[model samples]
Target: MKTIKKLSLLSLMSLSGLGLAQYTPQWTEAPQQIDLVDMTSFKSISQPVNSEQQAVRFHYSLLGSDQLSDNNQGYLAESKQYWLNTNAQKLSQGLQLPVTSDLAVIRINPLNPTKSSQSLNQQDITVQQFDQTLSVDVFADSEQLKATGMPVSDYTVAFNVHTQPGMLTLSMPTATKALAKGDTFIIHVFEPNSEYVLQLKTSQQQYAANQVVKINSQLLSQSGVNHMTIAGYITQPNGEKLTDLSFQQNKNGDYQATIGQLTGQSLAHGLWEVHTIASSDINGLKVMRDVSTAFALSLPTARINQQLAVQSHGLKLGLDVAAAGRYEVSAVLSGINAQGEKQPIAMLMSAAQLNKGQADLTLDLPQDLIRQSGFKGPFVVDHISLKNQSLMVPVQQLSAGIQLMPLGKPMDQDDLR
Candidate 1:
């Protein structure tokens, strides 16, 4: 009974068209709500440090959103008008960062009564420091408070803060790197989000085999930008343009580099690869970017030539033979000319039986056939077949005195004088 049950289980396992497995959700995070205050700033580190580090300031304003203001009541309705100013003195002392001489205005609406008291008269403050840590100060205008609402009613205004780091660098192995003769290599890049750019550069020699590289990129934020570009040089050993190399990106954001058939008589010995991506600067002038690495090339293999000859006769006409291998020979007897001309001649012999390097053949050329046909010159042979395979050889003209000799036999003579 166990044996029978095992056999039935195997039979069921061999059946096809089983139902597909269930798919699980790939994304789990909730979408972010749009912010009311859009803040953008540029910050950089000062070089050749002095006692006072370069001061960095932040400037921002409240953006009026028809969607956010829609259906607003009480305190929210009166806060949409007028430019909100920051308490820079209090913010500067609290954050311990320098305050710029200029005061930036934060715009707000006052007619909308639904505005919240917390969102009234807001201050936009920017802080500068040499250390990695920094803070932003937000304030609301008290004058924009609604008269009829609860004195302490709550209203929320979303703020988006973006920080741009300076002078970032990234490196990875490039596609142009040579693989060990029979092996393969994958070229790729590591990026935090779609807001970054990747650049790759390579030399001319590496462009020959560009099909082996792969790329993958993903966008993290819905508001982030995606961009890619692939470009490189095709220079010879002496630094000349053998060709131009270009690249294209696929749906997955991988750049495919391509170069047309290489031209120029001279060969190239050295190759280089390079690629670059310039991403959009969401917050400041210093955009996130990355570049693919470069690689050197190895030398190519040499070519080989093969040739053969037999018994000093040059093996002409119906007797032509070719060496297919170290010890294998094939016989060819007939063929057409290049000008579409046909040269038909009588077959004096055919290699009917062959063993090792030797063959037994039969000849049927009679004097009457040759004379009646008035076919002058050596008997021309075009092609020969053996073991279901055939080949053609160059036409060979034979002497009129030449006669067919039997296999493994000496020549017979009409006259030996």
Candidate 2:
């Protein structure tokens, strides 16, 4: 496997929170650790909603960030800003249905690359334009489950809005073993009686900004000529071309090239597809056909420098937004303790603005929350917000961390003392 493929695949396995992170509100039901059911986890489930509404009320996600490591372990956080810069056409078209996602990252001590640690947590279920009377519930609690790692079935979500009403509710089978297997997704588009078809494949669907998307293409059925060349272009979700992409043919009838570039004109977030116009010589005649295969671009966020200290009147938060402007930040707690008991705790609602895409601000946390939760340890803090004010499709640039303790030198402020 190539390096990029390995990392993105690893992230997919990590539930690296590409689509968004996970959440656990106080009201929702949570799974208990040490309990084993018929299987470890469910990869995919399908059932008609009990009501007319489809799968709108369902709330599910997992939080993954490289931020907490930067705060405590001196590791550099996720490269989200770079991702956005790479895919930058500011365009949103079509009124899709309700899209609601929330990522609340409870820290995972990667000490044992095998064993994952968990703290008790509370999260809210978010639903947009969703008027579904039916609710579908899957396993949302990855931390508290006996099966510690996230299941591949729960990691990815792919859908296509058809030309006609309704959709094909096809779900890939859950991986029987630890490592995921089989074709996770398939979108069947009927193109009958077409000639000179272009088929494209990539390393993976998910990519970070500035990362090269390894691509390979093959013309289905030789154009009846030994010498034929291929060329293509990338179209943004808004129907604008990011730029033109090209490739060279190898001996195996497959042409190889890198599909995307992080130029000023980006491929954009959301869905971007491959449409190719090939000029082929068929029996001394030129023929062309447009190939139809698409992939998605996802943005991962950067880390925020954060810390917590006891204040005389309340809790003081020192924050730093690494890159980009107008990011939303919030903090909360509630997780499993050493005794394996779930302890739901306080929330330090910290939402502040950053100037020049970066700044340092001292904010206040609810003093009452500090006393009630008795939080002397790390506080689970999540920093993420929608891009371009378009709520339907959000560009995720998140920083999830435990800001209170173990990040830096002992609290020097008098408040902690």
Candidate 3:
């Protein structure tokens, strides 16, 4: 009676396609650490964008002495600019001038329907500095003045002045010919004394939770004295200041700071920014420079252990998750070929709802897939990884290969069709 019951169970398993051999994987060495910096970080859910509105296209470029010239063919390409038409262009906008005594040139080019880059001589455009009339110069054959898809050569104008620290209001009044709908206005500023520059840099553009972040900064000052004061602070995605960064000057003349290990759950997941400001008295002139840079942060919700085994179902992997979430495990299977070199045979993966702490994640390795490859064991598992599907974050990864002893009939040509 017992013999009959055992036979019945085995037959049931065979019918369900669950009858397979199980074996433990042998490890030749310890697993190596995975580099998350090489992978793309997951992006948060984006907000819905409203339909495009009929408005003027506006852009502004703030350039320094390094970019200004009498006739610049690549002025449009070389200058760093910002697009400000979030909804529509306004008739009047406030323009903040950088603090400098440099020979500054501010150009306001208004776009129109027919000619994308209309010369100031063709349009009655007005610019004011502190509500006063500002003198301007017009250039008729500036070839690089055209907007995208426009003719290569177009006419434009710029207002040049030896400026002190102040603000200017740029006015593009709406009229029959001066300004039109769906036009583009570009404001370019050139400062001759822009040789003084402050820079900020981070160690990496992305980091995992609980990882230490390093920062280095430097200032190329034309000032005679090193009397400048520089400081910076970090802000969360919400624009709230997280903490002030204290930078210490090193022997290499570089300002450096390190953010202690980020505590999981203490820091928010999103884009974080680092802002720096430097002020100095260069040649008795008060000069100030400020800049900001951003980086992406993510949580390490789970990790994969060195333990690997082959069971009746498939290859089993051990996972240690910090949070309860759906986790995925994948590995590359390689077997020894006739040349005594290990060659890739198959790629396997599996995913399941994993609870916090230790969990067994199995990847299905079909017998037929391996049999057809004609590779012998012991097999090797490489490029293994664990990821949290709920958060869309990579938990861990390993490139070091995991060795496994041969199971029943590691390779059989008879099994091949």
TM-scores of all candidate predictions against the true structure: 0.21, 0.31, 0.46
User: Tens digits of per-residue lDDT for model 2 on 1-417?
Assistant: 598667666655544221111221121222111111111121111111111211111111122211222211111111100000100011011112211112111111122222111211121111112333222233234333425554322222212222221211211111222212221221112223233355567665544444576666665543432345767777765577787777888887677667554311123334666655454555544333345456544332223333434443233333333222333333444343455543434333333334333343333343344344443434443332222111112223333334333334432323222
**Pick by TM-score: 2 or 3, better one:** 3
lDDT of 3 by residue, 1-417 (tens): 898767776665453353234344765667644332311232332211122222221112211112112210111111111222210145334444444543565555454324533524523545555567665554333544454343432444554554455555545444334433465655555555566566677776555565677777666656422445778898876577889998888777767778965522212254577877666665666555666777655556666667777776577777666556666666666777777866666666777776677887777665565566566667666666665555554565554566766456533323321
Candidates ranked, most accurate by TM-score first? 3, 2, 1
- Model 2: worst 10 consecutive residues (lDDT sum): 79-88
What TM-score does structure 3 among the candidates reach? 0.46
Q: Model 1, 1-417: lDDT tens per residue?
A: 898767666654432111011111111122111111111110111111122222221112111211111111111010101111223222223322111112212222222233222322223323333443334334333332343342422332222122234421111122012112222111111223223333343322122111232223322234543453334444444455554445566676544564443311112233333333334434443233334343332111110111112222223222222222111112212222334433343333332222222322332333333334443332332222221111111111111112222233322221111
| Deviation (Å) of 353 in candidate 2 | 5.6
Error of 3 at 13 (Å): 27
Worst 10 residues of 1 by lDDT: 72-81
Q: Give all candidates' CA lDDT scores.
A: 0.27, 0.34, 0.55
In terms of lDDT, the poorest run of 10 residues in model 3 is 71-80
- lDDT for 241 (candidate 2): 79
